[model samples]
Target: MMKKWLIVIVFSLVALFLAACSDDGDKASGGKSDGDTVNLDFWVFGSTGYQELVDEYMEENPNVKITINEGEMNDMHNNLFTSISAGSGAPDIAQIEVSQVEKFLQAKDQFHNLNDYGAEDVAENFLDWKWAQAQTVDGEFQIGLPTDIGPTTMFYRIDVIEAAGLPTDREELAAEIDTWEAYYEAAKKVKEETGKYMTDTPQLVYNAIRDQQDLQYFNEDDELIMEDTVKEAYDFTTKMIEEDLIGQNELWTPEWGTAMAEGTYATMPGAPGWMVANVKGNAPDASGNWDIASIPEGAGNWGGSFLTVPKESEYPQEAYDFISWLTAPEQQLRSFEIAGLFPSTPDVYENEEFLATTDEYFNGAPTAQIFAEAAKSVKTVYMGVNYAIVDTEISTALVNVAVDGADPQAEWDAAIERITSQLERQ
Candidate 1:
């Protein structure tokens, strides 16, 4: 009887040990599986067919799941700031505009340095200026990849030009208007012949010209550099108003929309995507009459976005892998084909499909080729953290000068004073 009881006790101990080992095995498997099934949150500003692309990626990579959160352009920036400050519930990846990059980089410690994840070496794939926008003060990479870039183009109505008896073909226009000086001359001709304004607003021209400069309101040492290039922008905009090339309506208002539909403006120097969605999408009936051409000054970048990972993310490696894939040249090409975003990768410029593509909305013009060429020559500019504030003050000053007929020199002096004071306070 004692031997039988000892046997039963030994069997029970063996069974208990096996059960404990099974539990440990299950825990280990769960931990490894969690890495494969990482749940990533991503944020972007546009309702510009991003969901379809995300859905396609999920279909291809079933192991990973992405939840996308979108908001208005300005609201997304505000949300990013607020969420990063709290350091909790922040998205793994976020889309940041070029204008806002400097502002976000000021709180540099809040974001994962992409240089640590091997983003620095691949910088050669993007435009040099665009690549620099993602670097921190110490030359550390804070942004992962450039999703899109805006190489400016002049989207004009071919029919309108013909009606106005102006040059219709790209070559003719290019020959007649090789510089901003020639551009204004062509605009005067269009106005006289077609009775339509050449542009929507003087401020739009100002913004486009301002983006072409290599240095904005500040320098590398953070000192205000408010001479030369900036003065040129102000002077050019003032001349546009003095020459009556632009209508007085503010952009984004009902007045602007009405004028666009009514064909009050003959040409618009606009971002590639916006030119499609805003001008062509709003007036689809007017399709086949519009065409795109290179900007007068050869090329310049306007707006684009970079994807960044917050430092507090729980899965940095997974985030980096996903980001690298999404912004890869092939993936960006695919995205551009589906969406109207121009490619940021340098290699895409060589792809025949990218260079030869035509938009039905723009009278079947090979706009992609024109924009790609222009993007190659784009200049890099340093936009300091306070760029938005300074830009706003300068824009307001321009409005006073052009619209309210305020003294050009006096307005510029006051604007410089106000911007300098504001920067000091910050």
Candidate 2:
């Protein structure tokens, strides 16, 4: 009787242990077990004001944990490349700049196709062009979700314009400078009257004109095309430089910030929505003196980013869920308010609250409405994998001509040669 009782006790203990093991296995596989947890790591460059949103997300999702790692733009992108090449240590989520997207899409297999996670159902949530940027050429696989878009506009100092004897009203100024030629005339007047440069740099002018086109350095076939349109921009930028209508300050430099604060430049044309925050941050004391107008000859894009999940992510589904939620219309609007990241989600463009928003930093300009309109008007352009490399060479040539008085034609030819060489190597 004692032996039988012991045998029953041992069997019962084994059953309990097996049940506990099964529950643990279920939690490990991301089942709806009460104790299941999903941890995600996010890598981003620059501030997008995601911390607060993540806090709210965590509050609503007690079983999920998220950590954000912020790094410089170039550093972050380089690290992402290294991690992907190493086949480990990649972040669950990464914010890739618009220019870098094409490069990464070349190795699409490294990223998880978000389509597997119901990406198509939410496809309509973002702009068609934006949504397409992260998809395969055949439109089968998708790797990222759209985030912010940089809709180009002219950010100017109202006081400086008034000093130049130009229209101060946004609508009036916009109409007055409707075309690039009209803009150049205004710049001449501004320089003549205020003795301040009308634009930041020759490269900026070139970038604005280049961005206005539906076609850029490359065509849909990923073939290089250096057409007359690009040369026109280059020639026009050199003309501005020869006329001394642009400043010598390089962007992202301390000298540039000082020049902006001191009203050394009257206008910053072809700037994007995010530049509003940069302007305010760099020139805090220049508050209430600035305003925005539409970019000359319609809107162009400057900078934007998308959030992607790598295949190495242990929790791709959870990462996608968080990103999809984070970029939803409501959350995008909130991010805009917090970080001046213009929404890529068109649904927010018509929101009454968004349209009504104004900024005293820009002299009560209806900033949201202006940027929204520009964002909507932006023409989609094809930037191939080597767009950044080619663009860098061209901009470097422009800088050389602007700063060191390099011969324009020679520099242009050299830039082309350098771009050709790089592309050949690639």
Candidate 3:
């Protein structure tokens, strides 16, 4: 009877030890069962060709698999907000546009503090302003890495400018139109001589000028700052219309497409990607006639995105590795060479291959070098959460001023009211 009791006691002890081990393993794996493969979901705004780039990285590492979920810009923003609020199956990695950083940074704890993973060294390679956009109010670094940058340039048709008796070469045009005042003068000359407006619409001109500003729409305390900047943008655009330098057309409509295709506009200030798809898609026949130059201002950036790791990710280290690799200087250079997406890495600007390359689409002009020079001079600004709302209201106000002959000061006041109201709700 004594031996039988000892055997039973030993068996019970063994069972308890096994249960403890199982519980510990569950905690370690974030409730995932043993022997299960770890899958990471990555979300991007659109088909940005990151899958092909990531596939090459995965081929050497079989332990990790990445699944990309692509959606429209607005849809992706909504999805991120919903998933984050629910504390549910959010993506391990997500792309956040520069303009939306303020919104996401508000929930600072929802994202992994990237500084803990030695991302600070990588952050040093980017421009000061670009890197600052990823940090929270308390100075906690939240985002992963910046993949591409928006260094705006004036992409023009060499043939069109030549026909208008304007400077056709990049250097001459850059020199002639060094300031916004000079740019307006050139626009008037182009319109009067060739009957082609310098831009597609008043909003386009306003957007370009607004990008050149240090403060837009709002102040440091998030109060509406539209009175001065919006007034300036509206007055400038309205003057362009009054001076017959801007063509009257709706943006993104069939009429706009027709105008671009038929050379109704001579120049457009936009990012490098616009040259690849939007402009090229609209006017494929005018390929070799196009070229890129620095914008009226020395430097300005428009749109770009950063990859971030969410706090709920099961595999934070893996996500960080992938995000860092994707935004590394070497990888960004490859992306620029393949997709015409400009590199955010300052070191990539020194690359001889990037600086020397010429595009056949732009009459073999060395556009890479031109953009690289412009990217260096770009000044960064703090874009707040209600940037979109303010942008929309201001655009509407500008349209009224430019197209409807509305009073510029009155439109500016009205825009201030609307933008301030919208931002206050946020």
Best by lDDT: 2
lDDT of 3 at 300: 74
- Candidate 1 scores a C-alpha RMSD against the true structure in Å of 4.5
Identify the runs in model 1 with alpha carbons over 4 angstroms from their true place: 1-36
The residue-level lDDT of candidate 2 at 306 comes to 91
In model 3, residue pairs whose N, Cα or C atoms come closer than 3 Å (at least 3 residues apart or on different chains), thus clashing, are: none
- The superposed Cα distance between candidate 1 and the true structure at residue 152, in angstroms, equals 0.6
Residue-wise C-alpha lDDT for candidate 1, range 1-426, written one tens digit per residue:
999999999999999999788767744332224335767798889754567777887888787778889889899989889988998767888999988998888887888888888787677777777788888766755565788998887777787678777788876876676788887887888888877778877777777777777787888777788888888988877777767777777667787777777777777774555467788656767877778877777666778899898876766666777778778888878878877777789899899988888878777878778888888888877888888888888888877876787877889899989988888899
The residue-by-residue lDDT of candidate 3 on 1-426, one tens digit each, is: 999999999999999999899877765544445555557899998547787787887786666788998999888978897888889868999999888888888776788888877688777787777777778645566565787877778888787789888888888988888888988888878887888888878877788788777888666677667657656877888888777788777677787778777887788865444355677777788778887887887667777889998888877777888888888988888888666678888898899888898878777878778777777777767777778898887778777866787876787778878877766676
Candidate 3 wrongly placed segments (more than 4 Å): 1-36, 403-405
Backbone clashes, each candidate: 0, 0, 0
> What TM-score, to 2 decimals, does candidate 3 have?
0.91
**CA lDDT of every candidate:** 0.78, 0.87, 0.78
